[model samples]
Target chain A: MQDLGIRVLFMGNNFIRLLGGLWITVKISLISVGLSIVFGLLLGMIMTLKNPIVKCLTKIYLEFIRIMPQLVLLFLVYFGATKSFGLQLSGEVSAVIVFTMWGTAEMGDLVRGALISIPKHQYESGAALGLESRQIYRYIIVPQTLRRLLPLAINLATRMVKTTSLIVLIGVVEVLKVAQQIIEANRYTVPDSALWIYGCVFFLYFIVCWPVSRLAVRMEKKWEN
Target chain B: MEGQEKLLEIHHLHKDYGNGAVLKDVSLDIHKGEVLVLIGPSGCGKSTFLRCMNGLEQIQSGEIRLDGEVITDPKTKWSEVRQKIGMVFQSYELFPHMTVINNILLGPLKVQKKEKKEAEKEAEQLLERVGLLDKKDAYPRQLSGGQKQRVAIVRALIMKPEILLFDEVTAALDPEMVREVLDVMLELAKEGSTMVIVTHEMQFARAVADRIVFLDGGEVVEMAAPEQFFTQPETERAKRFLDTLSFE
Candidate 1:
């Protein structure tokens, strides 16, 4: 039996390399999720409008993004855009941009659902109370919409964090990329390096996502109360 | 009593609900401190007429004047018009997630931009009027149907509008829950708050309404004192309406 060196994880600065990769993954998700939320909220509001032009435009954007898989979007932005649009975009930048597009579409749909789920009488009640349109949204409509959306939004965030593993395909050097690097370095010396490193990679992703989903469930419970 | 000043005047109002006219040539005058109860069968335009006064529904061709200011004109801002007229609904439409005090405080605090301390203080008294002072910290879901309706009334009163419109408010309440909400309205009536109420409660209409307006088929068919209307109901449609509600 070939000696399975479990010691490669403890190899000088190797664990830190994995942590650095984890940090990169976290950074990409945060930046992408944050940008997606602001744009998604506006898009969501636009999608709810009765204006035909705005409704049609938002519908097109949402439908187009939703129909294309995120990985293909990443490929198009990373490789295809630089070739076709005469623009230069780094792998990490492309990853962030692609995730934002994907996340925004999902987020916007969630927000639209949340806003429409509210009874029509709610807006009428606010208007009848003499609230201006802005005040109606700020005080009544927005608050209720937010409460209905928070849990789903958080769940989307978790999905973003997990799906970020795909960024390794675009050469972003995220956690999975770092695991592959570790396995490649020990491939000849350690027989079980792939299994060990992949197991750790799986553990890292779980630790990142499980708490977020748990928080989502807990917040849903709180919203119900 | 006939010399009272007109508070809200709807003249030759018409409203279309995309397919056809819901309100046709409707006209009405609500006098200051007068409790006018609107009674009609479903789809008779009473609710549409009530909503038109509050600018919750747009009228096709007409003028609604509140304190002599034209509200139905194309240039009139709904927020400005609605500030003078408060409308409550059958569904209560209370902000379910908010505490009772906060729900009442929202209009005064956000719309009127009143101080929080002052709004909350007055809201407490208004809640007290509805006998829900103890439920100030409670959310709408925690309250009974009657309690929610009463809280909704308090929400409107805190705005201190010149006139209040009630759109079939008691129609959604349980038999036991209806009176508590009606009692709040009766108290407001005794206190001389000018109110336009769309209700099915004949006893409430007879006791509190200074005048009753019977609407049917998108038109006002009869307008008279509540006792006279309850006993007389000039039109055949109104007579049939009361015949159905005789048990109430």
Candidate 2:
């Protein structure tokens, strides 16, 4: 049981496999984050409209996303929809779809908060300056909204990256999945290898997320000053 | 007098909020290049009247004309009217994210559709006029209340409006800061820009206003030249209001 020993941790083959799986995870996160930001901004703008119909539609979408768990959402997209609707979605595509839905809702709410937090007088001042509605947004509303929304959006990006680990459960062969395979193959020779493998996975996630967290903190401090 | 034209005309202007009227049947005429000051106790609808001129507040049933064109018409284009009538708010609502230069350039570039370089050149001149040229690159948060209000004035002027509306522009400033903004306004007045100001500064109004309109309880109580209105004050309300301020 001790034949493989702790030496497997530094093996070149194990490192290459982990990096390959991590590359998949990175691809999923990046694609999902980009889609979420574009859709979320549009939805957020719709939600802020004075129309009752648009407001209600946005509220329904936001609440639906908020009430459902992300894991359940992934399962529905990956398993339930594929079976019930005769869909032929791959694990990676399913993960992207589910995470983008979740990220979009969260980002939309963040955008709404940023837009509304601006003092009402800012709009009034724009009107007084003879600015049209389009001009008001271009010159006044958007610039301020972007400044407040940037940090929150960065935090959301980090969240999406961390959450990519969950896609391994759906058989995506991402980072955590590779870690599981390594630990399973060496279970007889390397005792307690699962714990060490999982520990390494933790460090990998930390390495990806730590810089983003530092950037968020630095931005907050810079803006506050 | 024969050549000078009336720039603004407010006729029987009535404004109401829900059940009650805020401004009731108020009428006045302001001539070109004249400074008209509206002074009254709080809640007297002076600000509301100023807001109506710029189409910020809708009137219930009355007419406001700017240079012989009916501005209060529902069909009249507000953006067009707004381009000619620049308003400075009480709170000095400068775009907080933009630098003083950008804030001033926005109106010129957007409403006036000036090119960036041309807008920048005009903004530089306006900033210099307001004594804020050195602080062009500074954001609103970095400026004092007086400086912010002066930047706001430049922001409005960059549109090159024929008439300027000042809605208690100095009310938000410290006592020391008030004079600086008022001095800027006085300079604009000397340059022959027609101006309508709502103010609590009785001394400044007395010193600079060509006509003083005293309002109370949502109605104009007296409208006359500064000298006759202050000394004679045809209405008891105007005299009583002046007496309260005389001690201060």
Candidate 3:
């Protein structure tokens, strides 16, 4: 162990604070991702509508999010939006806002891809069965789309959790933020504290995201038949 | 024949895709219990004509009337009109997420607003009629191509529509699988279900069809009794088309 005394992992309340920071990370991701799913699903469905104007507007929004960087977006929301709009926004709220925008666009595109991939024959079958357009989507299209979207959606969730680390730049005090604070506090006593603390943060993210990845794989296997 | 009630009437129907026409000035009548088999070479618009009957494709001009009601006018709602017509496709298009029974029951339970028990009982009977009762719990992926087609037929039949449109339902099946689906259709014909089938199966048409309508280049080239059409086709194009089929 090189006798570097790695006790700081459990000492001076560092462990509990890391866990608290992790909880915040999970909470933000859960809320933002959940809301994004709802918004994305609606956006995706709207994008499929026959209206040209709606499609054009949604395309612009999707392109805007896809072309821009998340950090740039975060900076704009945190630094620019608050100052320009005279709104008092916290780092956590800004993070949520920025992540939701990105996640919703990605998820919306995933949903659109899944929806459009269903053969035209499927809709014809639904029509032949006397299904209304709404009923066709509810009873046929959306269910199939959901099955196709599951694996990608799970992957998106993990990406969201890891990407939540970006919030630290805006001072969200999440896991990575807490790690930085711990390392700076122990910079004199524990020379190698950065290594241990950052390592713990890495594993914390890995632990958070690993199960979701495994779930995606299991789902793909089960649905392949 | 003059006094027979017409279940569906197509009046000079015209349908067009963006680049060209698919059905042009076509007129036909389907009497109660009549079996009208449409045959033509590929791209002859037989399938498109069948689709227009059920409002899957909107006609550019003319009108379609079902049970004496105008069903092709812009005011007509396809969802309501379709309840009187059922269609089966070359690719079964069975809902992969649903079990066989659910696929059959979906129309009745959701569209017709039948109770679960009622729909399930009807689905099982349709399944039984097609010799697929044992596979009711199976998903579409678990079934053979023929089995999926059979379930698809049952899915349409469970609606008990007045007219059934079959668009080359056996074309995608293996040679061996085609017999089972054809047998089920033959059974339905024996039961006197009104049917419009677009197919290349000359033997089946000769056996079951009351009238054979030959279409070519989006036009109805000829209509005659199966014996008349098969033994003595009235049009040169149809004779050549049949000649091509026979060489295979």
lDDT of 2 by residue, B80-193 (tens): 888899999999688887788888887777777889998898889888988889999998889999999999988888888889999999988999999999999998888888
Q: Clashing pairs in model 3?
A: none
User: What is each candidate's DockQ, to 2 decimals?
Assistant: 0.64, 0.56, 0.73
Error of model 1, residue B105, in angstroms: 1.0
TM-score to true structure, per model: 0.90, 0.89, 0.91
Alpha-carbon error at B73 in model 1, in Å? 3.6
- By summed lDDT, the worst window of 10 consecutive residues in model 3 chain A runs over A1-10
Of the candidates numbered 2 and 3, which has the greater lDDT value? Answer: 3
Candidate number with the higher DockQ (2 or 3): 3
Question: What ordering of candidates by lDDT runs from best to worst?
Answer: 3, 2, 1
Write the residue-wise lDDT of candidate 1 on B121-221 in tens digits: 89887777678899989988889888988888888888899999998888988899888889889999999999999987878889999998888889889
Q: How big is the positional error of residue A157 in model 1, measured in Å on the Cα after superposition?
A: 1.5
lDDT of 3 by residue, B90-129 (tens): 9969999899998888899899999999789888888888
Candidate 1 wrong stretches, greater than 4 Å: A1-6, A51-61, A79-89, B75-77, B244-248
Whole-model lDDT values for every prediction:
0.87, 0.88, 0.90
TM-score of candidate 1 relative to the true fold:
0.90
Q: What is candidate 2's TM-score for chain B alone?
A: 0.97
Evaluated at residue A15, the lDDT of candidate 2 is 71
Please give the distance, in angstroms, between residue B1's alpha carbon in candidate 3 and its true position after superposition: 4.3
